[model samples]
Target: MSTDTDTPGGDADTAARSLAHWSEAGRAEMEAFYALATEDYRQLALAADWPTVLRAVTHDGWRVLDVACGSGKFPTALDRYTDLSALPEASYDLLDPSTFSIAEARAQLRPPFSAAREFAVTLQELPADAGPYDVVWATHALYALPPAELAQGAEQFVRALRPGGLGFVAQATAQSHYLAFYDAFRAGVRDRTPYTSAEQVADALRAAGGDVRTQTVEYTSGTADRAVAEGFLQRCAFDDAVSLDQMEAAPVLGDYLAGCRDASGAYTFQHEVMLIWL
Candidate 1:
């Protein structure tokens, strides 16, 4: 959800391509991406008792900001895997650089997540007077955020929180599937910097003066369908132009994908995500 446009030190051409893919024209790519990526949200939903977590930070009129919210998958996952019927209604603000994503995420809101404000801006561009929210979260949403801007972005994130409020972020570490695979993709298929890592995020938050606590969640999502695997991998690289066969033939990426393939030829992606609380 954190588009590279506003991220300093990001690749402009790559950022433009990534930004274009989030539009209506790219719906197919989005769907294909979500086919396997939905597991990412489901896994996070099961990571904790979210209702309790929300209740712990809720107040009479508490508000929540979903940073770089992508199709509102986190709240949708909460609705699917947990009950939020008893919680007090809270205003939910959506923030993302993509208008399509903002609309998609807004449509997914339910009770206890009454849709309120919509911010069509990158994290670095978030208005200074925007929020003092009781809950702020970004679920696997900061991958495109440039390393140079992580500290500033983290500062804005921490600044948005109200006193005694809760802040949460979920991201893949350097060795996780998302990060590792992207590294290989850049090496074999493209030439780009690695995606931001969870460790970097935690350090940035700490630099912003946040007292961060972390939990690790490990899981695997696999598919025997080659189409699904291809779509998943293509989405992972944000390059639908590349075919599965091409990926399987690349030097570094080919070896990486082969390592993930089992005897049945199913591709299994291993994920290790960090759940950070501040």
Candidate 2:
């Protein structure tokens, strides 16, 4: 749910800012994300596999701690894989840096996971003794963490999980849309922070002493609507202040967008995802 790419957040002031400011960008990104993600998922049968894995590896009962539990999409996906009656003792804990997102997570974390405890803090801010969870999960939440913070966040997840517990993370590859667009954004416009690639995250997990496994999934997201395409890139860069018109006028952005266009003139984004877990 973390909208910020593996983008390195600035000093404390930026970290402390309310996420309400990002709603416009988030909404803009989600619209484009939903349209393309659905098409890709259907084509590849790329459903989330977390809940199935959880059901297979659990004991009598367990607890789950979802870091940056972005609007609870994972929990919703979990319901599709199992019933509430099957895991009566299962408890959920939600953690996110956004206060606004905490409320959204509460609203969307259906049935079994709705009763979760909430933690409104970044992974780097999460206390070391905060958990002994059966599962520690971070979805698209870790994009904006700086290198050092990214390392700390990964260590926190490894430490948060109990012995024999599982840790899962889903993030974009270096060539993925989120990463590539940001790369272009920086090159064409101002120098913004870079996204933390999935490889870096997997390495951090392994460094934490967890036996890590990985899989790469590829997909393409394309839309013919120029408005949607422009908005998606704006939001991907986390800069809602810039308009599509401005992006087009910029020499570098214009060249980059030109490259992203297909024969049909639809803006196409090539995405490669890395799914890692222990």
Candidate 3:
């Protein structure tokens, strides 16, 4: 087995450049937005079925793979819930293409946790040595991948998992309330990637030879402050084709933000989570 990194798309430079401007300042801005957004990271963590999945793997030590594991948050959270001392010995592989994210994960990780490994490679080019993990996790990552690429990644995920092993693939559904907001916000923006619906994702998994189950997790923001709304808008306005000025100028942006802030002044968003087994 070899663990060579490959970027099948050959677009690492483009991706790195596009993400380079998102420095610590940008992260602070995004964190502020996350704090204000109707659906906070805490809610996403709780609603993501992490606890359930961990329970499933707690009995025997399981080699886990977290694809696009941002800031190592999910794995860290899993450690907290599973109680590292009581669980069987386990190794975690954190894979992502962002150097900044990998750095953050390394700094945040506690002892006994697996060392963070950086990969500027895409899912299609996952390292060959990652084979046959007991659990494969791709939470909130697949939605960012192109549909075709997502399918390819899913195939890789299944191949990497042992037979009867579990895989969790969470994606944003077309029916999500935030779809309208995202669509209007990215209107006319070139190189913008749209989210794939849950149905499309489940079908792709089935084609990849897995039995899949799905759930809808809904969350609402309880605050309607304009600063929060603007922050949310700014965090999402990172595509090369879309400028922050254009986003601010869009009439639809203001209207949609207002609509999201209900009588209580909170913005709410929804997402779909898919669970599969190979």
Best by TM-score: 1
* Candidates' C-alpha lDDT: 0.87, 0.69, 0.57
Candidate 2: the clashing residue pairs are 5-143, 5-144, 6-143, 6-144, 7-143, 7-144
Q: TM-score each candidate.
A: 0.95, 0.83, 0.75
Q: How do the residues 194-224 of candidate 3 rate in per-residue lDDT, one tens digit apiece?
A: 5555567678877877777776665555345
Clashes of each: 0, 6, 4
User: For candidate 2, what's the RMSD?
Assistant: 4.2
Q: What RMSD, rounded to one decimal, does every model reach? A: 2.8, 4.2, 5.9
**By lDDT, is 1 or 3 better?**
1
| Lowest lDDT 10-residue stretch of candidate 1 | 1-10
Measured by TM-score, how close is model 1 to the native structure? Answer: 0.95
Q: Alpha carbon lDDT of residue 230, candidate 1?
A: 87
Candidates in descending TM-score order: 1, 2, 3
In model 1, the runs with Cα more than 4 Å from the true position are 1-14
